[model samples]
Target chain A: MRAQFVLSEIWIGLRRNLTMTIAVIVTVAISLALFGSGLLINRQVDQMRGFWEGRIQVTIYLCNEVSANPQCQENGPPTEEQRAQIQTDLEAMPQVESVTYESAEEAWQHFSERFESNPALVDAADPEDLPESFRVALHNPQDFNQVASAFEGAPGVDNVYDERQILNRFFDLLSGLQNAAFIVALVQIVAAALLIGNTIRLSAYSRRRETGIMRLVGASNFYIQLPFLLEGAIAGLIGGIVGSIFIVAAKFLLLDGMQDYFQFATTLPISELIYVILLSIVLGVLLCSLASFISLRRYLRV
Target chain B: MVGSDTRHHNLREHAPVINFDNVTKRYPTQKRPALEDVSIQVEKGEFLFLVGPSGSGKSTFLRLVLKEERPNDGRIHVAGKDLARLSNWKVPHLRRRIGCVFQDFRLLPNKDVFENVAFALEVIGKPRRFIRKVVPEVVELVGLEGKADRMPDELSGGEQQRVAIARAFVNRPMILLADEPTGNIDPATSIGIMKVLDRINRTGTTVVMATHDAAIVDSMRKRVVELEEGKVVRDQSRGVYGQAY
Candidate 1:
């Protein structure tokens, strides 16, 4: 009987304030969707960082016949003695975890394999154009400068390049995007909360007569406030369900497109997206419930 | 008549169902206290009339009994429980034993007669079967029998007041507080409403009615407690709304 009464009350309240309810639902949906997107973006950045952590390296290209650098061109190709000395020096450095020499032929093969997804790009490159280099794995990716500075103008060196620098720039851009999403989501959530609070206030005002009678006849605070709380909760749940659709759409349209464009960047799987969706829904429900609870506080004081 | 069969009769004969001792209530916005150092005792099964002008603390007295407002000083005891010591959570339990009727009739406009009366039971978590059985009987008792399906707006002013009375009496509270229940209805209708309240009073329930209707008070000849400016000025048994006023 109580459940029926509460349900009926919720239905009545929702129907009575249809426009406000719809406004609350739409606001909550947009807010939770942005929230979920923020979570997904954060996850994507983490995944990319994890995938690249082990593979990042600093490459030192030797002075070869076809090199464009003034140091390499003037010196021509490094002698065998110069190559052995550079290799020994890199191996002795504390920051260098490991060093491996790649021949021009091997470099060509790796480049071809890396760009195999785009056969046209791989076919445009020649084996003779590739340079022989030492790929240095560092103890700490942040310590790339230590290795780069050591061999920058050393004999046989054409140019020293650290993959961390390029990867950091890319990760910085993703982090900025993630922060923007969070800030926007925060604003949306505040708007949603205010809307929820107003909806509850309007609902409470419309039902003041019932609540006054309820109080007179000995209805507990919970008993009197249950229907309003349920109204907010139902609005939140509906918003969450709608937001999940947005989240799924974002996964398919936004994240998937990103994955396709940046093939090496790892994006979230469906399972993780499902988790984020559930979390967003729960957050939406909590936000609305809290807002309504706050708005109904003065009335409950009786 | 709802809990007549199972109602407890263990209280001593001298014990009052409602007791207020030197209770003073002041609103922060108002200069004078609403009820200043006023006190009264109402025994079980008594029909009492609280008569006074508009701002004589009649409503405030009823609110204090229901623990709806806390007294600024002194204490109130209802049904042998000290209201000042009662926690906020226990206020509802205290209210369950005291039914309140208002001048406005305070009926939910959207609900029908039957639903309004049943609302009292439903809010307290009464079973559907029990509500079904008791709501009709109380509706009939208040003389709203066949009009159970009519909404509050559809009913006459008198009938609306009857529905409000039926809702108050449905819980079979030990103390019924009526704040000008007849204020909005005609004198003839007010008499009928009084009869219903008198009947409920005879059923071993204490009825405290605050009213401005002199004719009804003079005719009923019940206990009359008259207030003036937040202080009790007259206490008369079988009073006639007092000729001095």
Candidate 2:
């Protein structure tokens, strides 16, 4: 029954201050939208990260001259026995998945395919002079250092390169951008909370006389605080709804509609969109609830 | 209807509901005290009137008695709780023992008469079933049963005063403090409000009414305490308005 009274008072208060309520909703919506967008950017960065890691492989170049080094050297190409031993060692290792050995002729053919449009460059180069290379695959991409560690001083190897390091710098840049957005989102959320608090205070002031009369009529301070708290909560709920709308719109317009405009792409799962929307609602509820609590502390003191 | 007590009633041993001992109230912004060394007693079932002009601090006296403001100079006891020593949290409990009405009627303009009357009980965590049973009874007592669903604006001035009285008395407070309950109404309506106060006092509730109505005070011959410039000018057993007549 007491619950019914609180609910009834909240209902009347919401109906009474319709315009201010809408304003609060708009402020909360903008803040939560910024927060949700920040989260989405972070998730997108994570997805692109996994895609880049899967393709990062170590490239093993063979010697061009008849050097004694078994892996690679600038002076000479590897002997057939040395080449067979390297292939056997790579295949037998647990970390190694598969290694495709491209001979000098094959390497030249691969280069020709890349520059196929320019027939002049293809005819000018000698296929027999090109060095043989090993495109190495690994079971664990993060253990790329392990592959480099194993072949550091190998006999016939000229160089060992991992593509993953190049991709990491890009991830770092994206992470920095996401962090900035998060900080701004946090600031806006604090602003929204203060907005809610100020509005409640105004509401209290508008009816200051009535509050004094209620206090005179034996109404408890806790009882007086109930209506204002409910008013803040309802404002937050409306704000949450508006914020979720922005999140859904961003998902459709940016992620799907403009997919081809950007070079990198991702498939944002439906579950993730729903999670962001729910997160916006939770943030709205929590922020407004805190604002109402702080505002009531001073107002109810009198 | 005064109580059916032609027999000699012992007033002293009836347990005074409102007691003040040298209570003085000074506002923070004021250079002079609003109430000065005022000590008074009104027993349960006593009908008393506190009469004073504008600056005599009649409302401040009522506010002090209800624990709305603590006295700066001396001890004030209301319903057996000392105003100075009472915990801040228990202020509401102390207030519940006293009912108060205001000069402005101070009704929540949004709520209808029924909810307005129910508000007094609702704040104390009273059960809804009990509120339902009790609110209508007090509404009928104040002759506002027909206007239960009407908001404060929809009612006449006298009717609003009746609703305010109903709200004050619905909780069954032993001590009732009315601060010029009839100041805004006509003379005929003032008589009607006085009748309501008289009816409540006849039921063993101590009532203290602050007013400047000369005819009503002189005719009733009730106990009157008149104040001048924050000092009690006269405290009489059957006092009239301002000692003019």
Candidate 3:
């Protein structure tokens, strides 16, 4: 019965401040959506790093007729002995997980397959134009510099290339985007907190007379505050629901919708999306309650 | 009905319901104290009028009893518990035993007469069965029987005050403090409110009313404590308002 009374009071309070309540809901929804998006982006970045970094290899290109390096020109394309020696040295290194030899013809085949979507670029390259190289997989991709330096001045070597260096640049761009999204999310969250506080204050101010009477009638502090706290929680709960819907819609439109176009990119698993939705709801409710509780402490003396 | 309840029989017959000993209260922004060196005792089952001119500490006196403000210099005891020593959390329990009616009638504008009175019980977590039973009884006692469903804006000044009174009395408080309960109503309606208070008092409840209503104070012939500039200048049984001056 008392719960019924408290619930009714919460309804009355929400109804009385309908406009302010909507403002709080919308602010909380937008902020939580941004926060959820940031979290999802962080997860996506980690997944991409895991998938790409595992495949990263340091490539050692042998000197070919078309190679511009002085060392490659002097050696005139690595002799069979030079190629065998380079492969042996790479396999002997402790950091080298494994080495795969890609001959000039194999390199041309891989390049052609990669550029299949751009047939014009594929037809521009001659089969003999590609260089024979040893693709060196490292036990730890972070040890790329050690592998690169080990083969840098080796005979018949045109140049040492760590795929991770280029991948790092791409990941850096993604990380920067994630950071920017997080910063925006943080600002929105702060705005949501302030908005919740202001709304609660206005509601409390408008009901001062009723609260004064409540105080006189001997209502406990908890009893007086329960309705207001519930009001904030309800608003936050609605916001969270809306935010979850937005995140799901975003996933459908941006991630799932691009499935065919970016088949190589990993999509966030359904479980992760569900987790984000649940977390966003919990965060929304907690943030709003905390904001209102602080505001009530400051403004509502009862 | 005085002394009819056997539960209250164990309480000392002459024990004061409210006691103030050399109590002094001052606001932070003001140099002069709102109440200065005031001492008074109100016995249970008595009707006392707190009469004073404007800014004479009448409201402060009632506020002190409510523990809304603490005295700076002295002690105050309500229903035998020292207000100074009471923990802040226990203030609600103290207030539960005392009812208060204000000059403005402080009714919830959105609530009907029934809800306004029932709100007091609802806030205290009274059982629904009890609320259902007690709300109508109190509403009938306040003579707003047919008007229970009327909203505050729909009621006259007198009816609103009666709703406020019913809310105060619903819990059967031992003491009822009226801070100019009849302040906003007309003289005829003020008399009606006074009669309702007198009825409650006769039922063994102590009544302390703060008012500047001379005619009601003169006609009621109750014990009157009059203050002037924070000092209690008169305490008379069957006293008339402005008589001390």
Candidate 4:
């Protein structure tokens, strides 16, 4: 019977402050949705970093007939003896994890296969014009500059290239996007919290007469404040469910939408999205409950 | 002080349900204390009137009994428990034994007569079956039978005050405090309200009413405690409203 009374009171309070309740719910929903999106973006960037960082290598390209570097023009192409000496020197270095030599013909073969979808690009390239390179995997990818400077002016070496430079630019852009999402989500969460507080305050003020009567009739403080607390919880739960739908939509539109253009970078799977959804829902409920508790403390001491 | 212990023991045998000892209450914003060094005792089952003009400290006395305001200088005891020593958690239990009626007839505007009365029981976590049994009986007791469904705005001022009285009395509290229960109604209607309170008092509940209605006080001829400037000026059994009587 007491539960019934409390439930009825909650219903009455929500109905009385329908507009404010809706505003709180919408704010919570938008905030949680944005928050979930931020988490997804963060995970995506981390996944890309892991995928790229593992394969990062420093390559040493030998001078060929079509080489454009000034060093390559002066030295022409390296002899078999110079190439063999260069390979043995690279293998002797402690930072070198392993070295694999690729001939000009093998480089052309790999390039054609990589761009097989673009036959015009394959037909435009010639095998002899491609440069033979020694690919060196490092024990620590950050030691690239040490190896690059050692091999920069070496015999038959055209140039030493670190693969991470291009990848760093891409990651930087993605990290910026992730940080922007988090900042906006933070602002929205604050907005949702304030809206929840205001809604609870207005509801308490409108029902001050009833609450006064309740106090006169010997109602405990918890009993008097129960309905208001439940009103906030109910709104939060609804907002969370709404936010979950937006999260799923965001995953589809934002992540999967870019899959065709950036096929090499993997999108987050369903299980991770499910985790975000559950977390967002729990956060929404807790935020709203805390805001309501605080507002009640300030407005209704009873 | 040695003989006082036995005297208090004897007093406990038929203890005054409400006791005040040199109680003084001063609101920070006010120039003078609302109640100053006021001492009074109200026995169980007594119908007492606190008669005074506006700002004479009658309402403050009621509020002190309710523990709504703490006395700055003295002690108050209701039903053998010291109000000063009572913990906040136990306040609701203390309040459950005291019902309050106000001049505005502070009935919830949204609730009808039955719900308004039942609300008193409902808030205290009374069982629904028990509420169903007692609410209607109390409603009829206050002479509100067949009008249980009427809203507060729909009822006359007299009827609304009766609803407030019924709500206060429904929980069967030991003490009923009425702070100008008849202040808002007509003189003819005020009598009916007083009769309802009188009936409730006859059922062994102590009644403390603060009112400015001299005619009703004269007709009732009850114990009247008059206050002037926060000091008790008269305490008479079977007293009339004025000194001329």
**Could you say which candidate leads in TM-score?**
3
Docking class of 2: acceptable
> TM-score of each candidate?
0.91, 0.78, 0.92, 0.89
Q: Candidate 4 falls in which docking quality class?
A: medium
DockQ each: 0.62, 0.45, 0.62, 0.65
Candidate 1: give the clashing pairs. none
- Report the C-alpha lDDT of model 1 over A1-302, residue by residue, as the tens digit: 38888999999999999999999999999989988988988888888888898789999998777888998888888899999999999999998899999998899999998998999988887787899999999878888777878888888899999887888898898788888878989999999998988899999998888888888899898999989998999999999999999989988898889789778656677889999999999999999999999989954556
What digit string (tens of lDDT, one per residue) describes model 4 on residues B1-245?
87999898887768789999999899999988989899899999999999989999999999888888889999999988999999887787889999999999999888999999999999999999999999999999999999999999999999999999999999999999999999999999998999999999999999999999999999999999999989999999999889854
Classified by CAPRI criteria, candidate 3 counts as: medium
Q: Compared with the true structure, what per-residue lDDT tens digits does model 4 show for residues A176-271?
A: 877887888899989998999999999999999989888888899889888998899999999999989998998899878866667756768789
Question: In what order do the candidates fall by TM-score, top score first?
Answer: 3, 1, 4, 2
| Per-model chain A TM | 0.87, 0.79, 0.93, 0.89
User: Candidate 2's residue-wise lDDT over A136-224, tens digit each?
Assistant: 88888877788787775676676677877776776777677678767887888888888888888877777576667667666777788
Candidate 1 DockQ category? medium
Top-DockQ candidate index: 4
| Highest lDDT against the true fold, candidate | 4
Off by over 4 Å in 3: A116-119, A257-262, B1-15, B153-155, B243-245
Cα lDDT tens digits, model 1, B139-181, are 9999988999999999999999899989999989999999999
Question: Which pairs of residues collide in candidate 4?
Answer: none
lDDT, candidate 2, at B161: 93
Clashing pairs in 3: none
